[model samples]
Target: MQVPDVMTAIEISTPGGPDVLVPGKRPVPQPGPGELLVKVAAAGVNRPDVLQRRGAYPPPPGASDLPGLEVAGEVVAAGQGATHLIGTNVCALVAGGGYAEYAIAPAGTSLPVPEGLSMAEAAALPETLFTVWINLFERGFATEGEWALIHGGTSGIGTMAISLCKLFGVKAVVTCGGDDKCAAALKLGAAAAINYKTRDFVNEVRQLTGGAGVNVVLDMVGGDYIARNLAVLADDGRHVSIATQRGVTAEVSFLDIMRRRLTLTGSTLRPRTLAFKTLVAEELRATVWPFVESGQLRPVMDRTFPLREASAAHARMEGGDHVGKIVLTV
Candidate 1:
């Protein structure tokens, strides 16, 4: 394959809204040591991209200034110690630089695009999958036969959480904004879905779990929900915060935490070291890749936009009506 000297990438012209994402020309980056240069076929659109576009989450130092966090494509070149991966299809969790025709990826954080998975689906997996796996299962200690309370049941992370929970035998009870979204969640194997707009989720969860409460809460919404989330936890339950979409600060009662032996934790993946992400990639390849290869697990794809229309893709994600992952196809 003839790799181009220059390629098109979506750059944040200014921090503002979707319109701030503009296509621009840049030199095609060569992979560094232990890295692969991928010809991007598709890139996943994530909420963090929105936050970055809005000037909230800046890329970590020494990372690309581009917005995308995940991409799936063919490896066209490789740096020393990573030459074996050249010519293979892969999906990678990148810190940045995914929204482009050519992007560099660390070989360690890249996973083979397994059989039966489309590029778009592969692109969608890394961010949400790594997030849910680390926070919900590893950090929160969710196990088989346990119950998990997940918010934003229709979002990429929520939907991935539901699928993983279902596959691992954890009953997932999710909250959505509307009846239609709730129905979608249930149809996607959620044990139960609560319409938070119409009902109090705390009460509904209590009823659904027969007053035992959930074993873990995978929360993306922060603020007042933190207190409410803790209230609905079973004895020794865990609360893992991944995002603070509502707000960051919250007032919680330490007495309640002490009484229940509850645990609260959170993580942000972007700033984590490449070694950590590489380890996560290896874990997923061993544990979760089988499901992906067998077609038993797949991302819920909502839509795809052309590479030039990155702004429109961001708009669709922000509109809040899409039920699943959005992709930008090159």
Candidate 2:
């Protein structure tokens, strides 16, 4: 296939709201060493994209200025180590540039789209899967038979975490905003779904665990929740955070951490070196791809929009009404 010289893309015209996103023309990015030039079919919208558009998070050095993190497409061209992937359809975790007709992705971070999945569904897999695997599983060492308390259980990553925990025999308890979201989480195999809008999660978690507390707490809401998260952990439990949606700063008692033998950690994907991403990609491909291929793991896609309507997609995402991922078709 002949690749395009230029492509249509959504650009941040100004750092502000969803309306700030506008269509523009740009040269189609070519594959660099260890990269693939993908003819993007669909792209997943994530909360970080919203943060980037609001100027809260900037693209890392050398990453595309565009604000998309994951894309599923056919590899039309390859560079260096990526040559083997030419002509294959795959989903990738990209640093940026996914919201375009053509996008570049590092070969290591790309994986074949699971059989029987559409581009939009595959597009939804990479970001949330990578986030959950790295933060909730690897860093937290989420283990079988233990309980994990997941925040935002109806969100993309939350849904994946719940399913994965169930698949691997780790029980999951989750917090969502409403009854419907709570029901959705429970349907997805969460052991318990707490509607934080109606109940105090700390008390509910304690009640659900019979006072033993959860073995791991996957947190996205930081600040005030950090203290409470630590409070609800079992002895030697892990507290892994992937985002700080509530706020960043928190006052925690060191004595509590030491006495409980708790671990607190977090990570952001884009700024990491390609080598770090490569390690994560290898692990996911080996450990998680089987579950994906067997249909036990799948994207919980909520909605989609045409590429030109990127702003509207963002509006829907920020509205927080959707239960799962929103994708952009290119």
Candidate 3:
């Protein structure tokens, strides 16, 4: 198929707010060697996209300046070395450029859309699922019957983490802002949902775990939550940070970490090497995709907007009222 000359995309001319996300036409990108040019059907709205739009998170070297990070689309054209994925329906975790009608993806990062999921739903899967899978399971060493705590339980990453915990039979405690969010977390298989506004999360987690504390913590809220997260960690627990919406710097006790023998680590997917991302994508296909295909796991969608309305999607995410992933249909 012949690729088009121009494509519709949401662009950020200046960084400030969601209003900066303006839809415009841009030259369509071509696939390089080992890449596939995808006709994007839908794209996910992620916190990283919001950060990029605000000029807080810039794309890495040789990546698109566009804000989007995940896309579900059909392979329209494949570059050299990517012939096997031509004409496939796929959802991929991208470094950037998903807010456009066509985006180029590394062939290895693309995965077949799981059975019974819509394109929009698939678009929502890659970023959150990949983040949760890598952090909670791979990095944190979360295992069956282990106790885990996830902060921001109503967010996209939180919801995905909770479901994975349940599927693997790991006990999970989640922290959210309200009773409704808490209830939603529990419905998604969280063993307990603590409303951070009304209760002390560290205290609640301690009580729920019979005073032994949790074995792992998936924390997106940094700063003030850091001290508390450490306080609630079980001996040899792993604390993985994925975001720092509250602030990155925190003054905490190293003695506490030393006493508990805790493991503290964090990762951002966009800056990772293509080889590393390919490995993560392959791991997801082998260990997690089957569960999605079999209905053992599902994408929790909060809302969707048209491709031109990317600003509205970001606004909704900033509002912090959403319970799951938000999407933008291209």
2 versus 3: better lDDT goes to: 2
Q: What local lDDT score does residue 34 receive in model 1, on the 0 to 100 scale?
A: 99
Give the lowest summed-lDDT range of ten residues in model 2: 265-274
Per-model C-alpha lDDT, please? 0.95, 0.92, 0.92
The TM-score values for the models, in the order shown, are 0.99, 0.98, 0.98
Q: Model 1: which residue pairs collide?
A: none
Q: Per-residue CA lDDT of candidate 2, range 3-120, in tens?
A: 7788999999989999999999999988888999999999999999999999989999899999899999999999998899999999999999998999999999999986688999
Per residue, candidate 3 scores C-alpha lDDT tens digits across 242-309 of: 99988999888889889889999999888999999999999988999999888788888999999999
Over all chains combined, what TM-score does candidate 3 have?
A: 0.98
Please estimate how well model 2 matches the true structure, expressed as its whole-model Cα lDDT.
0.92
Which of 1 and 2 is ahead in lDDT?
Answer: 1
